[model samples]
Target chain A: MSEPQILIIRSVSFQQLDQNLPKLQEAFPGARIALLTHAHGVRQAEKYRAIHRVLAYPFKEGFHYRRRAADMKREQFDAVVIPVTNLSGTGFFNVLLFSLTIPSKRRFVCNMVSDIWEVSASRIIWMGVRHLLFQAVSSILSLLLGIFAVLFLPFGLKRLSKNK
Target chain B: MSAPLVSIVMLCWNRIEDVRESLNRIREQHYPHIETIVVDNGSTDGTVEMIQSEFPGVRLIRMYKNMGIEAYNIGFANARGEYTVIIDDDSFPAPNAIRRMVDKFEADERLGVVAFDVRNFYSYDDIKKEAETTDTVTNAPAANDYFMSFNGAGAGVRTSVLRQIGGYPEEFFLYNNELDSAFRIWDAGYKIQSFPDVVAYHKYSPKNRTSWRAPFYYTRNAFWTAWKNYPADMALRITIQLIYSCLYYSMEQRTTVYLKAMWSAFRDRGRLKGKRKPVERTIAEQLRVPWNVNFTFYR
Candidate 1:
């Protein structure tokens, strides 16, 4: 009704944010907007100089994230925007925040493919796929690291014993 | 004494039309001391605006994003009513539904939650046929002392008890959340009943819509619920059956979401130890007692 408080979550990259920012601003002209960019994109977002405030996602930083959430719970936003074109690792964090944060009335999942700002069910499906893919890849990597540590543990222990 | 205020908590997302219809139905109810709280899960279809402009009396809590079941926690925090009735956006209750549920609560102070007889709005003919068959062939129990869960769309929870157990578990982002709450209620020595006469109409639209995340949450939350509430032996057995069924469903649907869901559940198993408060073995057995075949929507 009045000036809407818009929160845009674009975690893909500064390039992606740059590409989408113009249209988003154009879509809601008088709205007071705040930006939550991925840590990697914070530098780019800070330089944009358009949004009222720019904040970096705490990501795996547990304590800071809780503080952020507590601070956010104090304020009410009119709309929350998720600009998703393709899935990236950072995009998953955006999705997690989307699941964690509570917005007022409007949630727009802006998909570049369809050039639409409406909530797309397909986008949810894609997010799940991307999330699992990340999980599978990370799990494999951890397993490999575990095997590497086991293979070298005996030699390192023997060397320590000899030195003693 | 004046009638206690009943707070109707509706968790809504982007189904603007359905939510409007549901709110209208609530307004049509005969209940006098009632308040409606709409927790909008970041709906982009002007749902908040519509509610503000049309139903000015309704309290609206807006979430910038969709927090799924966690929206209930947000609504519960602001709820000042003695009794809290949670209904889904796509569902609406019968005119007398609220009064009947409250009557049950009044009849028994120990009653914690009343699970309404939720019927499919679109399947009236089939439900009627099934009801007629059951009525003639069987003498089924009108109310179950131990309910598996309360339908989030059509259940009334005692506000004081809700606050005691710390509201709905926000960990359950979407699915099987009610079971978690139901178990805690039972553990707190409160009774949960399925009132057959108290009815609400659920459209059950998600069954037709394909969302891997829906099944994913169901599979994941099923195991999570068991781990958090059931005793060691019962939890193990139920989790095993759930995993097997999930595997079967995944194979049948040709989707890997179930496998992923299981992996996610097990990966997050570390948090269970601190949250676990296993119910009594006898109580767990009573809760699992299968009464008869009943059809639940796939969603």
Candidate 2:
């Protein structure tokens, strides 16, 4: 029921990081988000102050990936979403110091790369539907608990006071 | 001259520099017979002055205010060519792109359109991968392949086909107007094919991308485009894609717009119908084939 800090990493330059960020922000208000981008796209991150951080890296000779890993390690995000397509290959790996790991959510676009969690716009949507149902059920239980407290609690409190 | 090799209808708004660059390419064409017209969609960016001075020899049609994207239809109505080619001013076809596409029409009278491989400047890498190969829209007939794919940035269509199925819709100001046109051509017994070798590069601008209008019309028009063709299970396909889209994009604001677009398309279904020949493309009744594309609403 709480907002999760969504860490997003795509191969796109830093400039377009904010394009999808605002859409995410509108979906989850005040949600903490940090982008893992390349050095070229840093200006895009500056466009929004609400961005917790923008991690940039040099894209040659594997330097860019190291920066990406480092950003993930520093942020320690709740969950990550990568907007991948069949044409793309960027996928899961939670950030950590000295050691690399897989993301909490290992999803990518299906019909793209195989042997990985397939992610698509469809999955993002159904997850929201499931979330609403869970919240709705929990709300009903909270309501029942409030009713029980009101109906029988006055007599119970009075009896406890006399015993004391 | 020979009914003009191809009539060029350029739909433009504002960006004069981009169009001027494209017009330069058009002026250098090897084919001599041609008529080019620029339809100004009520741009306030001094596009009229630029077109007049820079593209002096070309004809110009100026609208008082933005008449939506259907303004191209006005230019099309006035076209005086046997074959009409619609290209956005931002995108430039190769010198021989028109000649190659026009050749296809001459090769086959029934060929309604020869849709060239419309490439964007950003997608050069993607195009380079297949530069060595030769590709055609469909080497076969329309009945053999079915009319499913189209891109309007660079393509030569028969003027007769335009009359047969009616021309482009005035409503879909930007996105997928070609797609809508493609289906109508197929339903009316004509064909639109993609010729891979006949390439047209879109020259995507760094400052201006087509996406500012994407979230609005792209999301909404996708389903509406399908609805215009598919009679049976359009609703189910749209609903499935809607859920599918949410999975990929985790933003409620974008999702809300997508849902609203579908709702609006349904409410305004009256506006879409009767504009062209009714086509049968719903998912339930669809005949799945190797080349037959599943036109799911992907915004």
The window of 10 residues in a row where model 1 chain A has the poorest summed lDDT is A155-164
lDDT of 1 by residue, A1-164 (tens): 68888888763323345456667777878888888753433433444445788766554222122335435666677777776533222223335345345444566755432243554445655755765665565455545544543465333323323122
What fraction of the true interface contacts does model 2 reproduce? 0.00
Q: What does the lDDT come to for candidate 2?
A: 0.55
Looking at candidate 1 chain B, the ten consecutive residues that score lowest on lDDT are B290-299
Is model 2 an incorrect, acceptable, medium or high docking prediction? incorrect
Give one digit per residue, the lDDT tens place, for model 1 in B43-66.
999999999999999999999999
For all candidates in order, the CA lDDT equals 0.65, 0.55
Worst 10 residues of 2 chain B by lDDT: B288-297
Best by DockQ: 2
Tell how far residue B218 is off in model 1, in angstroms.
0.7
Which regions of candidate 2 deviate over 4 angstroms? A1-164, B1-4, B122-146, B205-207, B210-212, B233-255, B280-299
